[model samples]
Target chain A: MARLSLNQKTTDRWSVAEAVAGCVRAGLPSIGLWREPVQAIGVPTAARLVADAGLRVSSLCRGGFLTAADPARRRRALDDNRRAVDEAAELGAACLVMVVGGLPEGSRDLAGARERMAEGIAELAPYAAGRGVRLALEPMHPIFCADRGVLSTLGQALDLAERFPAEQVGVVVDTFHVWWDPDVLGQIRRARGRVASFQVCDWITPLPPDALLSRGMMGDGHIDFPLLRRAVEQAGYAGDIEVEIFNAEVWAADPDAVVATLARRYVTHVLPD
Target chain B: MARLSLNQKTTDRWSVAEAVAGCVRAGLPSIGLWREPVQAIGVPTAARLVADAGLRVSSLCRGGFLTAADPARRRRALDDNRRAVDEAAELGAACLVMVVGGLPEGSRDLAGARERMAEGIAELAPYAAGRGVRLALEPMHPIFCADRGVLSTLGQALDLAERFPAEQVGVVVDTFHVWWDPDVLGQIRRARGRVASFQVCDWITPLPPDALLSRGMMGDGHIDFPLLRRAVEQAGYAGDIEVEIFNAEVWAADPDAVVATLARRYVTHVLPD
Candidate 1:
């Protein structure tokens, strides 16, 4: 099994400087960094800080929202993803995670939006591969099907994976997103080598209004961690199970306390001895 | 196709009497009745009113909440559903829909609770079958994955359907509960003869906090109803497209307006002309 990592946004209270320092201080092995924080601290400085602090980049925070029906707007999204891929390459991240966008704004045509998403990602896949950055398509929860991601199931991601030909394009296995899927176990088995990232977080019972980012912390919700961990591992994903929660309450707490607590919980509850 | 039906609770303003008359005024073929107005007006009187008003009963409000986890509580739920089955049978309704309960009150173990739901449904299936009330399992949206219904996917309902091994235990496809599914078209195909009921509402873009209910009226949200109707029709389901929108605002409006608008929309946007 690979090591577990901390996603930076989970400890959003800290700036990039404090976050990296605190992660290293906590003796964690791997971490994922988002674009905003990296840009805020400067990519070179952030990369140097991560290297100086001896932390491995599990994956870069994300790079795709390719569902605009307009060709030029789609091209612009691809251009932005190109920048993200460059950033991921700089950080030596394992993968450039992509969150494919949902229905094109104001468009009730999900099929059209999904088609646009596929074309947009296919356009970016080669650019990402050229830079040695693995493009990871993250299928978010079905609740985000209309507003956040059209690829709301792992099976949909697997279908997308088939179009990649080679394993250059991959999928993300986020427990918070796919935990409720009855076909999750089957899709993970099917994903095997095509899975580029594995994310862990609790699926809270009752989600709040801004369901897009109101993620629950580990052990605070109803997902079965051991079962999910076993499924992802059995699927041949030897990658860090990055904790990527977005709880407002947790983010408002002390950075060190949050990291320490997450590290402890991830070790005790998530990681198998 | 069975004629379109207007679900009364979608227009919660007036009483059941008003909803029935509104449906009649609009020339709707069928209507979904609620238990509230029945209780408010006494079941016998409400039954006479609906019968005299000449509205075809598509289905009785609901039954089954099988997840108390405790046998005593589960038994109470069964008792309630048994009575509901009788009520639905009395109404000359086509089916008794069940929104099988989520994790037991304040419980977190979803898997175990789902097992309890299956067992409860299996028990109720026989009684409902005997009473000539088709048992329709309405798999809810994933947003209600924790405390409402663990059976968040229609595939899960089909899997459960295999256990009862009868026409009695079937599914009710409500767009509001399943529009976000990446595999909805496939499931509708899989549903085939097992679809005891069919419904239409809409998936609003920014999902409301209260998802179990907050369904938008058909054509008001993102669901492509004609496409969905075509899929179900292709799957051999020649049944009523009962519009079951649970929005509080829709309910608080003029009941007649709500019914009339839905009837008009069904004719123009959803149903095949």
Candidate 2:
């Protein structure tokens, strides 16, 4: 069977362990867990469940929001990231994805803010490698470029990856962030095997300036997933195709149903040849 | 006094001729007119006032929505673009900036959607060039990826730029849309003098999802205009920065106040070196 990983965030309706167990039960070959899910059930128990199900942990959801201007807080962020890497390693995850913080809170210096992000990533890259985890930097959508992730383009992420060899640092091209990029095809070709993760989600415009939590499911919005997956696979990406949707509606629905629906859609639209 | 270019959409709050005369009398050095404004006033009169006032037309706001699957309609769009180029030439504008269409009315094929965009641009480029007008592709905010412009990242726009030469084609790097790009600096640098126009506006977030028209005025939002301008200038862009705000509140205000406010913000924040 072709590989598929269900990101825990999609079924955030369930706890981390339940998500892991449920994904395995649904016959998914792999799963991705977020820190919140692990924290809810405790990492050890969550990791144990994945092991119990023999589910491959494609990656830990994230470990990089390093935009705090305070040096100590930024250092603590790195320390926490090392812990995330360690946790991912313990769970046998192939990579530790980093969202990389947006503009430091209340700060508008997008350039200095991004420099801090690169510095933060550089600090954690070696630590993540030591923990035996590949660090994947996910350049978010330009919409998130201001405060959530300063890195908003794949070319920028690939540019940073150029600083590290293919082994240590890489990029995660998410449909939610980069589906709209005009050069995504070229950047994916450039990323090739260095693309550590390929995720699927839809971009929705949320109201309330601080409405940071709403996202759509794969096909509910306008994202062209089949083509996006084709681009990633064409770029020599052989890793798990993870479904990492962050939708308020899905989270509120029956977790089992969401997984079932996603499975059906993935089989029809995303399963590799 | 430094140069000022009026985006006629700004004065969409007024009739086209009145808006043009107001801007000319206000001592603005240049102006940008939208298709609707030109249509409302008749292209010849729109062209004549600017010519009579000796106002340099910086750019024509748009001439693309190339996502129609119907070849006849798509051909109509290209033909309309041909007319837009002629109108731009009449007004002595710099380029016919394209917000290259979004998904075809009912389809979700983003890649195919973009292919349609490229095809339209390729079809329109020659006509625009023959009329002494350049096609300036604008990369809008990701929020509009579905219903509006799908080219969301500056890297994407630059990649599109690589498809054509600077003289015949280029891009309009509007900060309101792309200031959040992590690759903004690199892309802007890559844009070099091929930057057909530099547009400035503020970024504001409205809750719930009415973000399309909620653009903030400079100095009122999170954009660091000075830094962005510096990057654009460093990228070898020597173009007049035009304020293309789509703010309802700003637009509702007295046009004079709006222009004066923008000029003040421009002097304080975006004064070129």
Candidate 3:
């Protein structure tokens, strides 16, 4: 229970204040914050609200979209990421999760897009390190490779992360995005000492019309949560395990109820025996 | 142009008779046949239709889904696959594409599901070989790993295919599925003789509400068709290149127009210099 964090996205309708209150009421020790909610409430206010509720910010989601072809857009993205690092620092987040952007518009060069992402991370890693924020590269599902994140496997993310210092850059093991990788267990082992965060959600099939919201509540889908948790724990990631489902149905539920459901599932499916 | 094969699903609305006629009208030398359509028109009749038109059946559009948990259901799947093999042999298809099933219902055991798929394939491979049909494992994009095919990369497919004789087991290199893989080029090289088929289809973003229909016409999406075609050719595959798109908009268009569009795109985006 101590390591269970309810990512705000599991109950996306909840305001920052509401999320903090819900976490405390649900007896959760931490919460994963999204930038939009924190920004809406003012970063300081949001940070204070969570602290006052005795909740730690497990992670800040997110700080990357580094694959824009236009030079101006790419520069703006880098500038924005630096600001995100500052916010993550202010919020005392364990890491700044990155959903690196996909291919530049009208570009068929996947390799080129990946190169740009590496350059973006190289430029931002030092800035993030200076702020005591880790850049957590999240390898989203391959479905999102073209439009959301070119980094589509834990191995790919780790390859990029390994280029930077362990304290400065790391990888996010999000179940929904990577549960299908046959090499995930090996990748988790390889990611030892550099796993920035471990997120739990389930893979539900017949993905909703909008694939992004296809993430399911832990027990509602077919992921072997315990297996992933054990692998991450074995990899030395003894940090918060965030429940970050992006399902429309879950989001429509009451925030408190959502938190309660997440806690129950976390105990049943994710916690180490 | 001689190697271009119109996969029936690209104009899904077209019946077997219509598809055969359409291919002949477009001066296409081959067509990729789906089991449902062939079964509808009767396999022998459908085979005769293609043969009479001097059109080759580039490949049969499937025969696997071998990941059922129920013993009875699993047996049924194998039986169906045997029938698919007979049809492929009857049609003189270069290979029978396999879209292996995802995890069984009420199961979160991906590894186990994959094992079952392997067992099923091992059993079917001999039967396929006996019938003079090659079993072509098509690794659908990982997004479909949970519900469609556990074989999600060409490397994974080749790993399984390598376990059997090349004539008994092979792999389908579909651009839409394997384009995102960083190791795709290397995998294609490894596939060489076991490269049963080379499929072409562009990957469009903002995937339609239904992700399955998100495949775009060549040149309409982000895939560099020539790059992939070159890799496949370099791998020593000199067989027909099948255009297998699953798009609602494309299907809604007239079949002749769709074939014309596919041919135009094939020349502009897929054909080598």
Candidate 4:
């Protein structure tokens, strides 16, 4: 329970103040922040609210979309990520989770897209390190590889992360995104020092029409959460395990009830035996 | 065009006879068959029909759902796969493509499920080899890794295939599945003479409600088909290249028009330049 964090997206309707109040009310030790909600209240106000609540910020929602082929769009993406980094630093986030963009419009060259993503990271890692923030590269499920994250596997993320200092660039191990990987255990082991954030969510089938909201509550799906939890723990990721579900049903549920359900599941499904 | 094969599912409305005639009509050199339609018309009649039309059988649709945990269910799966191998031999298919089953009902033990799949392949490989039918394991995309295939990458399939003699077990390189793989080109290079079938289909986004029917026609999605075709060709596989799309729109279209569209896409997107 001490390691549990409520990712704000898990309770989509909650504002920063509402989420901070909700986390404190739920007896949660931490909360993961999204940039939009933080920016709405202004970063200083959001940071002060969490600090007053004595809640740690697990991670910033995202900071990468570096696959833009156009020079102006790519420049905007990098500038936006730099702003995201500033927000993470102000919020005292553990890291800024990176969802590297997929192929550009009208493009089929995956290798080229991935190369651009690497370059984006190389350009950002030093700046992030200077700000005392780590850029956490997330390897989304391959289902999202064409439009979301070009980094489709932890191994691929590591290939890029390994190029930078471990303090500057790391990786996120989101259960829903990586549970299907045959080599996940090995990759998690390899991620040792570079595992910036460990997120928990279940992979549900009959994935909604919008695949983006396909995650389910932990016990309701087929993932053996304890197995992955144990692996991440063994990898020395002594950090908050954020419950970050994106399902529409979850978003529609009463925010307090969603927090209660996830906290209980976190204990039953994710805590080490 | 000489190497192009129409996988029967690409024209779901066609009977075995109609599919064979359609191939001849479309000037396709080969046809990939599904066991259900082949069994529906009786394997002998279907085999004779295709042989009579002088259309080579590229590969049999499937065989390995061998991850059953129950003793009776496991035995039945092996027996069914054995029958599938017999059908492939009777149809003179170059190989029998295997989509290994996912976790058993109410199960979360992925490692155990994968081990069972390996054992199933081991048990069936000898019988398949004796029948002169190679078992071509198809590594589905990770999206299907939970419900459809435990084998989620060409490298994982090859790890299983390489344990058996090359003639006894080979692998299917379906572009739709492996195209998202960062290591696909390297795995294709590793496949070399063990590549049994090369399948092509584009991957479109906003995947239809049923993820199973999500594949798009080539040139409609983001896959670089010619790149994949060239990789398979360089791997020393001169086998029929099967176009195995499963889009609902494709299934509902006029079979001949669908064939014509695929033929054009094949030459434009898949053929060596």
Higher-lDDT candidate among 2 and 4? 4
Write candidate 2's Cα lDDT for B143-209 as tens digits.
7888888787777777777787788899898888887766677778888878889998887643224
lDDT of 1 by residue, A65-177 (tens): 89887879877888898999999999999998888887776677888888888887788888888888888889988888887788889999889877884457999999898
Best by lDDT: 4
User: lDDT rank, highest first?
Assistant: 4, 3, 1, 2
Residue B160 miss distance in model 1 (angstroms): 2.4
Query: What's the true lDDT of residue A224 in model 3?
Result: 92
Best by TM-score: 4
Native contact fraction per model: 0.68, 0.68, 0.69, 0.76
- Per-residue alpha-carbon lDDT of model 3 for A57-160, expressed as tens digits? 99999999999979999999999999999999999999999999989878888899999999999999999989899999999998888888999899999899
Using TM-score as the measure, name the better of candidate 1 and candidate 2.
1
Candidate 2 deviant stretches above 4 angstroms: A165-167, A203-214, A234-236, B21-26, B48-54, B106-111, B150-167, B182-193, B205-208, B230-239, B252-254
Candidates, ranked, DockQ: 4, 3, 1, 2
For candidate 4, give fnat to 2 decimals: 0.76
* 1 versus 3: better DockQ goes to: 3
lDDT of residue A97 for candidate 2:
90
For model 2, state the Cα shift of residue B30 in Å: 2.9
What is each predicted model's overall lDDT from 0 to 1? 0.82, 0.80, 0.91, 0.93
Q: Write the per-residue lDDT of candidate 4 for residues B1-273, one digit (tens) a residue.
A: 998899999999999999999999999999999999988989999999999999999999889888889999999999999999899999899999999988888899999999999999999999998999999999999888778899999999999999999999999999999999999999999999899999999989767778889999998888998898889989999989999999899999999999999999988788846
Name model 4 segments beyond 4 Å from true.
none
- What TM-score does the first chain of candidate 3 have? 0.98
Output the worst ten-in-a-row residue range by lDDT, candidate 1 chain A.
A205-214
